[model samples]
Target: MTATAPRPETSGPPALPPLAAQVERLVALGVLDAAGLDAARVHDAVQAVDAPGLLVVDRGLVPASVLTPLLRLGDRAGFVVEDMTDVDAFAPTDGLDVPPSPVYVVTAPDRGDDLGNWSPEEALPELAARGRSPLLLTEGLHWALQVPEVVERNFCYMTIGSRLRKADGAYDARTPAVWISLGTGRDGRERRGAPKVGWCWWRNRHTWLGFASGVDRLAVPLDG
Candidate 1:
């Protein structure tokens, strides 16, 4: 088998919106309402942790179950794969301490395009070696929501930092990812170009899907 060449960064990381603007985006998406969270309180919390970071709403406030369908890229809305009805079941793997707060920030996030064609099992150690952490599924969604350009044709990413732990204590092999729908299969013709929350097997690799990662996470202090 021929070895595939590594891909380059799709482009420089697109600039993220101001933290305040990002909070309002959540409001616009009805995330606040769906989460039963007050927009003002959410806004204030984000303000306290404001910095050059990607604002992410922890699954506690709004489950991936709810947020996936609310994602928008251009005229199309986001969706979870029909087979992935248990999307919320996936959680941060052991040792990946996602903040307990409802809103937090991921600093210096990147779509690891250079790691394209590498399987999730292959990429995790590389990310740790680089002193970076893999992004959670929701963090990837937050990045796309704040900067839609991160997701496009021929360039999308995986969020393998999370995995589903079965009742037997073995982790499910399906890893979550965010990408553009091809408008084929169960996606329906109209969903082409829409953002999609889906999954891939831990050992599988796709030439176009890269792993997403970040330098660190900055949690807003829980006690205000």
Candidate 2:
């Protein structure tokens, strides 16, 4: 009889953007608000990124939690979270089983230059135009419960991933539940990072979160 070989075990925790680095990046981009960014907020933001797992825990769609508060703190913040059932207004044409979370739509500033020149006035409308619909507004935790599937579907379609650790010291896979502005532009489009796919687990002890593209691309001020 031939001997069978055993499968090798995967090693190490999944790779993720450093929480502090992410916060710093948000601050540098002027995304962080005056209420101030802190470690707890960073952790919460990270957890919210894993939308799917969060839904499972919370038993529904994930809310805007971290993103909403942060955006609200910023100047000239705008967003909309429309129901998937209202397909006439949203894109892709597919109906979502879950409800929608508040979408942050900020106007891009009309700075003469492209790099870090965005002002509040220019960014708001540009962001809102990307997604126009009746958005639901509520706490992050509540949002997660209302539309778990919708969150998961968006993550899948957008090719985003998430990492989560539970408070009870458990590990679970998560998918991006919310969208945000990714500074990096790619292929005439923007490149954002999330889980690769088919990798969704989480620890009961840790929180979950995910990220997605807020707008197709950074909105540059149109010339009159």
Candidate 3:
């Protein structure tokens, strides 16, 4: 994730923005909210079209069909578009292995009070030692529905495929946990200088869980 500074300022035209820019454009257009969920559309599209977004592929429909419509909307609205729905779309960064497939984990911090299936004692310290303040739940926030006493020591594991991450990378199963600091997570306030190891995702009924990545792969996309 560590790349040296710029080679030189380009006198030529600027580069195209990354896919995130288009996503922002979508937000401004009411296609999605600041949280990135196309609520009304997700409901409408799912019912009427039977896909969250779609393209009439041949005579059938595709799953997670939001990509095409977004691309078309980006073009129609005059913005650069890129497909970033998956890790395969991003230009790889060194040591940026995928985090483990997220599970519906409802856990609380291990404050010497015996509770929860997972009890991570070293992950937060390691990340802190590396000067990384991973995202966390705001104190007094009941987002995870964790019982009052055992709330907020949230950590997520990494994955290689649909299975779990079994590689001997720096963040393997042995040392596979990452931290979650306090903040307005869905508001995108967590983005900044440090590399984005992973992200937090949840629904009204789901626990506020996150993915932890070791590599930093952030390239600002254009608004075009």
User: Which of the two candidates, 1 or 2, achieves a greater lDDT against the reference?
Assistant: 1
Model 2 spans with C-alpha error above 4 angstroms: 1-14, 37-79, 83-224
Relative to the true structure, candidate 1 reaches a TM of: 0.91
Model 2 — which ten-residue stretch has the worst lDDT?
107-116
Give the top-scoring candidate (lDDT). 1
Kindly list the per-residue Cα lDDT of model 1 for residues 89-203, writing each as its tens digit.
8889988978777778899888988787888998999899999999999888888877888886667999988899999999998999999998999999999989999999999
lDDT of 3 at 29: 40
Mind giving the per-residue lDDT tens digits that candidate 3 earns over 1-224?
Answer: 12222222223212222233323443444434422454444333323221111111110111112222222211121111122233222221243332231111112212211111222333334443554332221111111111221222332222111112224533222221112323234324432111112322211111222222122212211121
Candidate 3, backbone clash total = 15
List where candidate 3 sits over 4 angstroms from the true fold: 1-118, 137-224
If the candidates were sorted by their lDDT against the true structure, best first, what order would they fall in? 1, 2, 3
Candidate 1 regions exceeding 4 Å error are: 1-9, 222-224
After aligning candidate 2 to the native by TM-score, how far in Å is the CA of 187 from where it should be?
A: 24
Which of the predicted structures, 1 or 3, would earn the higher lDDT when compared with the native? 1
TM-score, each model? 0.91, 0.20, 0.19
Determine the backbone clash count of candidate 2: 54
Count of backbone clashes, every candidate in sequence: 0, 54, 15
Model 2 CA lDDT for position 55: 15
- lDDT, model 3, position 91: 23
Model 1, CA-based lDDT = 0.84
